[model samples]
Target: MVLRFLFLFLVLLYSAKVNSQLLTDELARLNNLGAVFDDLNNDLKQAKKTKSISQTTMAHYNLAIFCSNHRVYTEALHQYNNTINLLEEKKNDTLYAKVLNQVGSIHLELRNYNYAKDYFIRSEKAAELIRDSVLLALATSNLGSCFEKQKKYKEALEYQNKSLQIFYKLNNDSGLAIVNESIGSIYEDLENYKLAELYFKKALKYNKNEKNSRLASIYNNLGDTYRKTNRLNIGLDYTNKALSTAVEIKNTLEVASAYKDISKSYNLIGDYKNAYTFLQSFLKVDTENKRLQSANQSNALQHIYNSKEKESQIQYLLQLNKANKSQKLVLVVLVFMVVVFGVVWYLYTLKKRRHISKELDFKQRILKIELDKKQAEEKNLQKQLHIKTASLSRYSLHLSQKNKMLSNLSLTLKNSLQRNNVDLKRKLTELIKEIDFNLAQEKEWDEFMAFFKEIHPNFINKISNAVTSKLSPAELRLCILLKLNLSSKEIASILRLTPDSVRVARYRLRKKLPIDSKEELSLYLMSF
Candidate 1:
């Protein structure tokens, strides 16, 4: 009986180990797949050469993401449509549903609010069908954002709350961080800067020491909050950080927004030069966006107006025709009294009404012609917006790729340790610890650069020399790592250094830079 019990325990242990190994392997593959997706154009080329359906689907999805990033809505839409077709054949409903959400997101980014809402609703349905809480939460969160953009404050808050509840239940830290940020944005829009700041700070705490593009947005909101509270200096400081982060992430739109916020702060303080500088930046971003969408919306509006105007004219003309028919009948009835002066007056009035009707008909034709012109313009604008949205989506993907390297390292380390491979375990543990440490604080940027320089000496020198900022190789490495939001431990592992050594390097990097002691070194590096 004792032998039987021991055998059962061993079997269970082995089963558990196998399961863990499988999960880790799957995760690693997924991570690498995601990294490959970052360079979709190249991947597609390779996939075409291999004729792999999975690769094809992946390529299509990657292309869709790229299109979405660049604001190429139609192209993105096409890619997604093709991907769905491929996914359908493979019977991968889970991924299909996720793609639906992506489509919804693209629509939302394009400002097609109703279309966006429809897509999100469909995505939520798909998630429900698949019983995927993560997908459900993501769909709900997207709906909340859509409502927020539409200025449906109460509805937006409710959606956000729903998403937050799901994220909490799922114990998804990243989702929770996003929810916190969304909540903060709603408060900011409602003019409750205090509450907004509270939420922003919560999100910041959650996302600390990471290269999260969302953090830049939160920073921008925090700056706005500070400005609203009449803390101009604080506002400027935060805005600068936000701007720096946006630049690091290559998020032109957010960078433009940050500049506008800074300009507003400067304007409030009567610093015209700074304000003007920011305004120019704002204008550049705004003009480009407006050039893409304004004409389309205007043309659409004009077409609708003109169509209505023509319809109204037609109704009036019909009424005039009816009146003329009645007049003709009266004239015929009065034919016997043609010699009477009153009959002459009646005929003259009928002729005058006919002339007026002819002029009105002419105007209606002109209006219809104008409407056609407006419709054409609207199409052009839509095309431009599609292009821009697609462009932006690519940048977002790039950000994701850069951050995934650290995650991969962590996963690899964890796997090696479990395998009981002593050398591999030690190496992975060291790496995991290093990443964790870099992420432990907000000022590990300098340390990250030093590590980066050690890995890519040539690239660091090139980038450094190209820029006016004389950041040392170490500082530059730190800057790139900071952009990725690596934990100190992760940085150390990548650089093959002790945790203490990593800390000392970070200290030296900070001391070498010209920044306030309290300011985050990553934020400082981004400013350049």
Candidate 2:
């Protein structure tokens, strides 16, 4: 018992070790695939920057195919849409048809039948336009699958037959195998077990060289057909084979389908215990598949929402850019108008200032001419006053000499009469009295004074107001001579008096005037 228990423990440990190794190998393989995908993505970005649109489109299509095969359906759909958009812009019908077919397959997997049909139809049209036989075959096969999903077996068969003929013409063994499998699935849905078996066998023969998930699917279909026909042992063998292939390829959906078929076969053969065990296994795998499917669906929805948001943002930015350009145009026009107005105003002010400056210069020249004329008239008047003053001085000197000669002649006559006769003494006395009367007369003095007043208009009145007493006529005559800058001898000669008598009269005049002892009387009088 101890040895048996130890053996069982050893077996269990070996099984666990194998499972761990399998898991580790699977993880390493997936990591390597992810690294390859990253490299491809980098190459795609570089191609876009270089504006190699053809290379960019090819890279995106390749990545989409890779993701689709790996069951990364959301990423696969996104990449496929990107490829389609690029191909459309380039008008590359062949490539565009290929991408549309792949996109339809993805929508069919998601159970979006309407979307799948639309894409498939569009792809078929594009392929037909470009005469691409391989692409048209693929698109027709996918459209048949869509019809099969909808339970329209007649329509599905029609499209499948069309695809099969094209595949034959092109010698595409893989495409022929795919179409055969789709037709077999539609027959199975119609409950025609014999016909389904026949097509499944043909698909298996064609798929023999293709070591892929599609081979596992054909195996699963074959297992289902045999089970429906009551071939229990054959059905179990085929179902187990399908499970093995699915595990090797890591195709979870196919694996679950194989498990379900195995469980059904066991139940039909009266192996209730084994059937229950297989059913539990099927349930576990199916649950895990549903969980993964749910996650993929959620990711796909999120991707669609994000794409719509990006399109909205692009439209908003375009409108804003247009508004900015319009505002800039208006601003430029306003600035131009302001500059033109400023230039016009500056030119007007400059012209006005020039006219004002010319007018000012003309007025200045006229004033200068008037001032010169007044100066000339004043000079002539001064010359006339100087001549008149000189004439008055000469006349005063002549009167002084005539009075001295007359007095001397009268004295000589009086002396001769006294020596000759007493009778002649009375006549000589009368003659002396007549000569004195003529000498005392003021006719010449009056003429000289009148001439002085003409030249020195305010001289007499100004001197009288300045003196303390009123001036006699003799003093007035003396004051006028002093104002003319005359010497005391010249003044005495003009007055017909001796120089001593003239000095004595000036001293008396000085006492009556407001003059200091240090001031010359003639100079003081001339100041007036």
Kindly report which residue pairs in candidate 2 clash with one another: none
Error of 2 at 240 (Å): 1.7
Query: How high is the lDDT of residue 230 in model 1?
Result: 99
lDDT of 2 by residue, 182-266 (tens): 8898899999989999999899999988778889989889889888888877877788778777776667677678767777887
What local lDDT score does residue 519 receive in model 1, on the 0 to 100 scale?
96
TM-score, candidate 1, is 0.44
For candidate 1, which ten residues in a row score worst on lDDT? 391-400
What lDDT tens digits, residue by residue, belong to model 1 across residues 73-154? Answer: 7767988998988887644378888998999888887799899889788889878888899999999999999999999999
Give the count of colliding residue pairs in each prediction. Answer: 44, 0
Candidate with best lDDT: 2
